[model samples]
Target chain A: MKATNLSTPKFCSALQILGLALMVFWFAAPVLQAAETLKLSARLVWGTNRDKSADDELKAMTPKLKSKFVNIFKWKEYYEISKKTFQFPKHEGKQIRMSKNCEIIMKLLDKDTLQVQVIGEDQLQRTVKHPLKPILTDGDLFVVGGDDKDSYGDAWFLVITHPNLGKEHKKEE
Target chain B: MNEKLVIQIQAYLDGELSAEARLQLLARLEKDSEARELCDSLKAEQSLLKDVGEKDHELPVAHSYFWKAISDEILPHPSPRNQTRHKQTAGAFQRWSAWLVPGGVIACIALVVFQKGLLDDVLDGIKSTGKKAARRAPSFHEIDSQQQNAGFISFRSESEGVSVVWISNY
Candidate 1:
């Protein structure tokens, strides 16, 4: 027996619906672009470099740090402690809170550079224009006690900015 | 005569009437000239039908062959050229469909692969993460918390656009 003509309209209607959906998606794609971001990790270590002269305070914190190193301080070495990870805005500028009464204002200078301004606990501020290199740049800031002596320790910073870090971090979780 | 009486006459001629009905019908035929005429006409009609039906006439075949006969009668002539053309069209359609089914499927898969930008995304992810993983182990910055204080101004990943800054005595 010859087949009747029945499926033509249904097939055409399906095509029309798909075409309409494509048109809608094409028009709305740009407005749905995802927000871009960056991840930053700051590690503060209070320890005498094995090569440097041992300070009294660093010598005291060394044994305690080594005892709690693996659990509390995953990174090795004496007097090396504390780590903070934060996300920064990719498109504009914002002051990221680091600790009590201390915040760093960061401005995205471009795709590869950042204008970083650090405000210390004493209300003193310093700014550094740094590139997003994988290597470390030291002496970004120095924290001195109330006594203010040559015994004051200097801090070094290593900053890495990668586009996939946030995504990789999220994938790990 | 009325339709009911005519029907009764037909039934009687067919020998379908009961004995009581036959008696009542015979009485009606005796008293009514119209009823008698109808009965005679019906009887003559039935006899003529029987004579005509029995005289060397062919009996009709059952209706089981009716649709087949109608189909043969109305169908177009089976021209060899037309048959070959139909077969060729069907064969071409089958061959094309054999290729087109898988071809269409492969085309759809290719479109989906490209549409989602899967290859580029994967390559870019590997490239960026690979760069990071290939880099050297990070050097540790040691500060004496008791002798000197440490403060974070800001830390940011330029590519990722994230940062953290904090001040710590230790």
Candidate 2:
């Protein structure tokens, strides 16, 4: 007996539908994921050689987070001056005040790209644009910091990250 | 009797000879008794064979079954060339069908990786443009400092997977 013919209309229709579905998924996956507003955590951290901050309201940084800062900078201890978690739509910017002296304006330039403007003492200090997907997906840190004007020897950091990035990374593992 | 003459007589009886040849052979047969006798025997044998062939013979199985068996044997045994052509067609179909899904998947993955800038990072790492470039693993599209007193330095630590942008106060 002859084998079944695949050139028939039924078979061709099925293949066409399958191809259309895959193409839709290819384009739609990123759009669907990017459609939701981005949730981010911005922290104002004080990095100093002193073991503790003079202000009692400041909280000590998490051990896992402190280890990351310790490995990169010369700071002996890290204290969180303020931390804010917020969500903003794509291609738009949001202003978050982490502390009285430090605030940051974050803009989602694209799905995985972000532009950050750091304002310290009501002055625009720096503007940086970086890809946020790799950092967030990989559970990495994006830190913007400089020497403190009030305290000459100490430095301050504006640490931005995805709040759920670590949990997602752990799930992946 | 000569074998050649017997063959000629058979041809003459079968009407296979041309008109001239037929007349010549007929004249020889009239004169030759041996040729006449051989021709008669050959004609009688042909008639008997024809009768036997025309006689109805019953098959052990039904007629349809008998014919079907022969068709089954002959139909399944296709010519070697046709079989090769069929195999080639099937092989091509299988190859295309097999690769369709995987090829689509690979294309999707490549697109996603490219869109995510992972491919660029990999390429940059491979090129290792400079000392600073090699260390700058963070995929930054742009960076600017608004104040003259403040400047920014950015680098990535591959070991910790961390990107640091240090805003230095000069």
Candidate 3:
């Protein structure tokens, strides 16, 4: 049998391999970037002048976080009714139930943005999009709150935060 | 020669005319010499083109060289000094073009990474500024409440590092 000229120069073959690798990386860059998920924590807090919560399961708010609310609003005490820690994928929405009557839908709009919809009594109360970068980097908080309809002068707050940053803050505390 | 008769005769030659139209065209072709001549010329031209297409024809030079020669002939010839300058310019252009695709790809990747980093930095700066500002300042980019029974107000206390959206009457 005649010998076939299948041999390619080593340099050319190496360059070809490098090119193939670069092409694969170029195509995969976006997908790899998109794989990153945003971790968040949402808390349903009840604000009242009363010293204690009627539900024993409810926990008092962190002193650092509650002081923030006390400075801004009229509520004397803030109690955490429910808390959820979840991950948000890019452009996808997640519905989180904070209580029987309170629900929140959060969507990761992009790398630096989050869309939040507050649902009270199965009705959409508000929709907000928050710039995520500041919240993620600066440990900023996003809260959706309203007056407690059942109780006069009582209020409810839905607070959102970056879980990692929140944990770091707690560690520092 | 009538243009209509010429078309009919051509269509009959191509076997495209209806049977009744072909018979009428054939009768006219026997009676009209000018129509017959036009039909004969169109057939001759079609046959000549087919023959030229079917015959194998080879270029005297390589395909690239052939095109280059034709382009050289069509484009103006430069002076010796100008030709050297042109070659240098072309060489530089070719070198740049070689790097253009890879450079562009790298630039795009860098831009995406940089923009993401920059966004974090800028937003951090904004938050810092908001923190340094007065109490009850807003931090959210947008807030839209759709419920008629409830109205909402949002603010951020940078000192507390907390943002609040207070919905009233809900």
Candidate 4:
């Protein structure tokens, strides 16, 4: 082999070509790898909802939370612990971390029957006699038909026999 | 015509009568003009009844191709133009928005300037009234609870609640 000197024009061209090749390789490698295997993730706060999608409903959730996390956080994400089952990360408290997701899809189902009633604004009772009484007071929801005053101009509420939703909720207009 | 024959003629037209009644009505139709007219009217009515129940109608097509056809015909022409116009309109709106913040601040400042004199007069009146009240007001100190119970109580002569017990004239 003929030994070429370092100052040769051919040596400079070869070095320039090698540098360009390395630049192109590293630039295109990441793009190709990203297209091949993508790792999708979203950021979530410590204890709140994500976007407006209702797919994230937390129900039967009885996680003992610390005061700093439960009150101050604006969002929360979740991850799967097992197959189709998941829990919030136990980082500082029992709340989820921001690494998994900002939203947790916890679908809730009512096991028992729900009874709804309306409370009348007027003091007098109605003429039509119902067999069962209402469970709630005036302007309250009845799970099994409470003592709701059935008359016009009275606000009504929803009552569920389910333990997850035992409290009275304002009915949407 | 006899009443029994009239009843037979009615029953024959209604298909309730025997062959004798039908034969009798046919013979009467040959002779009686009114009987023939009634048969012609009854046949017309039966034909009309068959047509009454039927309507030349059709069910609505699934998914309503009306909107789809309209979309296919009208959408491509306007969609890109609509997007362009939307962006243009948004640009115009953003340009207008640049003026809005300054305009709102100017309006708020103008409103405050307009109401400033009235608010200042009210505040000035309140201050003068406070000064007048301070000057006209009494400087009496409230006696301690235990001290008041131990001694005879006194009220100013202008007091509304009780008569004065420590008047100099007394």
Candidate 5:
């Protein structure tokens, strides 16, 4: 009786087919996600556009600033720097010192809003509420700035948001 | 032809039997041709093993050439000095390659940061003076309920490339 060799052509072909199927599944899985869901992100940026452009004028309406584009408080950047700088269970008085003797006082107003008070070296204090929108869509920019008029400003709070940008666009509240 | 006699003959050749058992085996060997043949075979095998183990014994072929062919096929031997040099080069390469991981991570971070700076420049350039109405109105539901409760309203305009959010109470 002839013994059968385990490395037969049919067995190898079956293994190759299985391996090919796994590769196909691995590559195709992410593409099969339901295209209906919308993804969004929001950022609260506090910077002086220091530029003389009218848009910077509108965005940076604060008066008496030192340098342009001085990012005093950015929501994402601040929190990241703060969490790393401070210990756990952060308190109200937990402050992050910015450029030109500007100190940022953080307070959680609500689940969706954070109150940041930017006090400049000149003792000019500007308080702005940064709202954390739960749902963000594409191309949505939310800007919250201080009432700065001249090229020099104390601080500006900007929030960029993107909302309900989905393929279906079936209005989701 | 008896199996017991055959065993006894082998035991006698090996000197494992007592004197009385040896004498019995000798008598049986005289009577049994099969027992005698078995004893002769065992003796011949013992002598053959001795001859093979003896240093003066000659092989059918040259031993050095025979073993060298087998060693070449099993393992190709390189010069020890060259092997040491190759290993040192490989080790140096491995040590250098170890730095590549952190280097790659830093490079990726720098690229992202550089790209972000470029994007910020472009966005800043695009943000000029404009107060035109937004091309698309923000969906009412897109407004967060928390912001509404706080008297805050968010208005986004991509054309303006700026989002204007304000508090009504202020």
Candidate 6:
């Protein structure tokens, strides 16, 4: 056989292979899925382009939950002082409630460097200090955060950590 | 009176003078009219600090009875200093550090966010942002009875500089 004999796959053979591939894809799907323990679900949106308006771009990214990050900060120097203190607005955002043994963690993309993990016990008791970078983990989901390494850079992420179970209170005798 | 001598009289008024120093100062005070005036001025400052304390002793109470009752019940039993410290790690400044436990966390996280470059500026910025609940699932494998299974998943950040692993439990 000449080297040129292997050109395009034969149409009948390709059709047979395509059918097999689809079957394989479907079969491998769930087993592959079981391997995933965490899901970071969110969207990014952008407003108009240089030529387009910011409003127009955001509208295009509609409903996806993602957006172009607008960083307008530029100054001669970083915060001139150390020990600067700032307060964040408390979030009364949706309280993601779940059954016992299920924790919900929400990381804020703009507010913090450390992920905040709050355990969701029955009454929110019990302090377990494992020192695992304050990550929130459930049997099914995980949420974590890290800080920007650039010196005095303004990137931040807020990670919310919650335990699956609440601390049990000691009953009074 | 000389300024130095006036200062000496001020120290004497505060009871910071020794016996010989007091005797010497007293002699000068008796001889100099200006020394006597300086002593009167020093006495006024001492009297002022004392009066300030008396005034502070009468501040209005801040807590109402009802609020106190709620606080007593809600706040956990903070054991005595000795017993409380017996449980936590020990150091001379441990007590003071306790006050910082909550506030320290707030700062560490806030600083990291600022450091991570999560904030990219316009034009030369990441066009999109948001976590992709990466929907890739695994293929199922036939297992023998009572056999354990294991698998791994990998992920990368937008910069692609950092990667993480999600390991399955079984």
Sorted into a CAPRI-style docking class, model 5 comes out as incorrect
Q: Which stretches of candidate 6 lie over 4 Å from their true place?
A: A1-173, B52-68, B71-170
Local distance difference test values of all predictions, in order: 0.50, 0.77, 0.75, 0.34, 0.46, 0.36
Model 2 ranges off by over 4 Å? A1-9, A12-37, A51-55, A110-112, A165-173, B1-136, B139-142
- Once fitted onto the true fold, the runs of candidate 5 whose alpha carbons sit more than 4 angstroms away are A1-173, B1-3, B14-20, B27-82, B113-170
Q: TM-score of every model?
A: 0.33, 0.52, 0.60, 0.15, 0.26, 0.19
Q: Best candidate, lDDT-wise? A: 2
Q: Is candidate 2 or candidate 3 better by TM-score?
A: 3
TM-score: model 3 vs. ground truth: 0.60
Candidate 5 lDDT, tens digit per residue, B1-170? 77787777777777899999998888877887877888999999998988787457775888878876776677656689978987787677556556654555565555545533555444534773433332234333222322233465555544444545554432
Question: How many Å off is the CA of B29 in candidate 4?
Answer: 14
Tens digit per residue, CA lDDT, model 6, A147-172: 22332323222122233211111121
lDDT of 5 at B144: 33
lDDT of 3 at A68: 77
Encode model 4's per-residue lDDT on A57-147: one tens digit a residue: 4331223211212332222422221112122221211111222212112111111111111122221111111111111111111111111
Q: For model 3, how does the per-residue alpha-carbon lDDT over A71-168 read when each residue is reduced to its tens digit?
A: 88888989999989998666568899989988889997766668998887888878888877557666778887888879888888888887875566
**For candidate 1, what's the TM-score of chain A, rounded to 2 decimals?**
0.43
TM-score of 5: 0.26
Instruction: State the lDDT of candidate 6 residue by residue for B1-170, as single tens digits.
Output: 46789678778877899999999989988999977987887788888888777333666666676676776687667569855675454443445454555455555455444444344322223442422322212112111112234343444333221222322321
* Tens-digit lDDT string for candidate 3 (B1-170): 76777677767778899999888887877898877788889989988987786566885778868776777687667699987987787777657656765765676666566645765555546765554542323444577767556566766666677777676777
Off by over 4 Å in 1: A1-9, A36-40, A45-47, A50-82, A88-90, A99-102, A106-153, A158-173, B1-121, B124-170
Candidates by lDDT, descending order: 2, 3, 1, 5, 6, 4
Worst 10 residues of 6 chain A by lDDT: A76-85
Candidate number with the higher lDDT (1 or 2): 2
Find the 10 residues in a row with the least total lDDT in model 2 chain A: A1-10
Top candidate on TM-score is 3
